[model samples]
Target: MSTVVNQTTPHRSGSVAVIGRPNVGKSTLTNALVGAKISIVSNRPQTTRHRLLGIATFAAGKDAPAGQIALVDTPGLHRQQGKFSASAMSKVMNRAARGALEGVDAAMLVIEAGRWDDEDTLAYNVLSDAGIPVLLIVNKIDRLRDKSALLPFLAQVSQGRTFAGVHPVSALKRNGLDALVKELLMLLPEAPPMFGEDEITDRSERFLAGELVREQLMRQLGAELPYATTVEIERFAEDTSLKQGELLRIGAVIWVERESQKAIVIGKGGARLKEIGSKSRLQMERLFGRKVFLETWVRVREGWSDDETALKAFGYE
Candidate 1:
């Protein structure tokens, strides 16, 4: 008898744009699907200032096909208003969101379950206008008190909308994702994986270090100040002199628009800044799976958010 062998090729692979209003869990969903926290998460709106690619590859599971999803995670799409919405930073964010839709196979319009406000509609309009297949992902379903209301909420949002498929998922709990992946894969044509299976994101470790620091600023600072701040990785190097292991040496500058904000960030006797650095270093170690020595400084940039030249230098895109 002759020995028999078989091989399976990925049935689908393509880019997916995750677009929605701020604080709608788009980044959380992207992190969940990618099985990694490449995109930072914070409670504040517009926490994501840059467009990042999260690569999620699923092996041929019993209920899902073998494929790779190149998730295009962009900043939130919203109508410009309020302090954050009025500056060049907001324009850059919105522009990045819109620009991410170009040359994508599909778009995932993420929205909180049981809610569909004007901003949600704004995001929907943006995705629909992209002329690609839009899959409505009703996220945060686990927070609903009445599960029966889910059907009605889904019906309400689906009205007059041409979604290729609708899935009610709790990106936090990791529920209802398998089926969503199955449907998402079928919508794409057969193609090889866009990235290596082991790769989780397209961003470099240096860029991730800056974003991690920014995540801490967004979480630890006052409500208004976080929006005015951005993190810049001034130095990132590997130190291998120690016998323990390779250590990452990172220097980050927290750029605020004013002096008062800088004082506030430094906190009473430099406590707040220390806390931020400690938390950020731990997060970086966990994500990169290496020891990290992180040093941070709070500096004033004087209208950097509104200044295009300053924004570019600070790595805002």
Candidate 2:
């Protein structure tokens, strides 16, 4: 009698760096794939200042095998020249983007539909030098006025370049993502899941709490003012007094470079600061799945963004 040989399918798991220029919706795509708001999103450029991991695990499907994708969501690659971009903080952000690409099995080069410039080329060059498989993600196609123009745009970008796969997607509307996920998973190596299926991110709650507050700053503040500020979580602790669930008490300090900037963030009668805190608390509760009691203070840090030491203290690395 012939014995039947048992065969098992392999699981694909590896890291993929999300590479793009500023304001290209890299973080939005990262969160969409992870099924959680691990990275914050805003219209302002360089909103993502640090490297963060977003883990996405998928079940086996008709077209794709089971896999886990550890997304290294990076700071948008940008040139350092403008007053905002020339600061020490900007240099740190660029370094963080390059560093996050180390040891990744693949990369997703995200770009806005119908737009490509020097910064985008800079990002593509960095990824190409890594010698890893790249998937070109043409994001925000839904935002384009002429959807028919998408194909030509994709063709223009892919002309002299090599991509493992090309996908047009709307990260905000969740369009064309199922196929994108399958394409990305195939680029990874066959291995067991590196992270648990339930894990959406590798960042700690304290780190995420601070980031949520910073996200509010980027959204609510004036263009130049937001660049001058950063959020520091002074305290994060759980209060288990409630019967329904534990309450998270978080304290955040919005650090500004000047006293005038502090006044701007606080607004008249502290209304602006209150709005920031309220919105931030709501986002924290949504992400943490628990009640959050948050307190915010605007403090002057005297050019903290340009200070390397201050950047390290506030977790720039």
Q: Among these predicted structures, which one has the highest lDDT?
A: 2
Q: Per-model C-alpha lDDT, please?
A: 0.88, 0.90
RMSD (Cα, Å) for all candidates, in order, is 3.5, 4.2
**Candidate 1 local lDDT, 1-317, one digit each (tens):** 01122145446899999999989899999999999899999989888889999998877765556788899999999898888688998999999999999999999999999889999999998887789999999999999899999999899889899999999999999998888888888777799887888999989999999999889889987485867888889899888677545799999999888899998899999999999999999999999999999999988878888988888888777
Identify the runs in model 1 with alpha carbons over 4 angstroms from their true place.
Answer: 1-10, 222-224, 243-245
Model 2: residues with Cα > 4 Å off, grouped in runs: 1-8, 222-224, 240-245
The lowest-lDDT stretch of 10 consecutive residues in candidate 2 is: 1-10
Q: How does residue 243 of candidate 2 score in lDDT? A: 57
Q: What's each prediction's TM-score? A: 0.95, 0.95
The lDDT, on a scale of 0 to 1, for candidate 2 is 0.90
Using alpha carbons, what is the TM-score of model 1?
A: 0.95
- In model 2, residue pairs whose N, Cα or C atoms come closer than 3 Å (at least 3 residues apart or on different chains), thus clashing, are none
Q: What is the lDDT of residue 195 in candidate 2?
A: 90
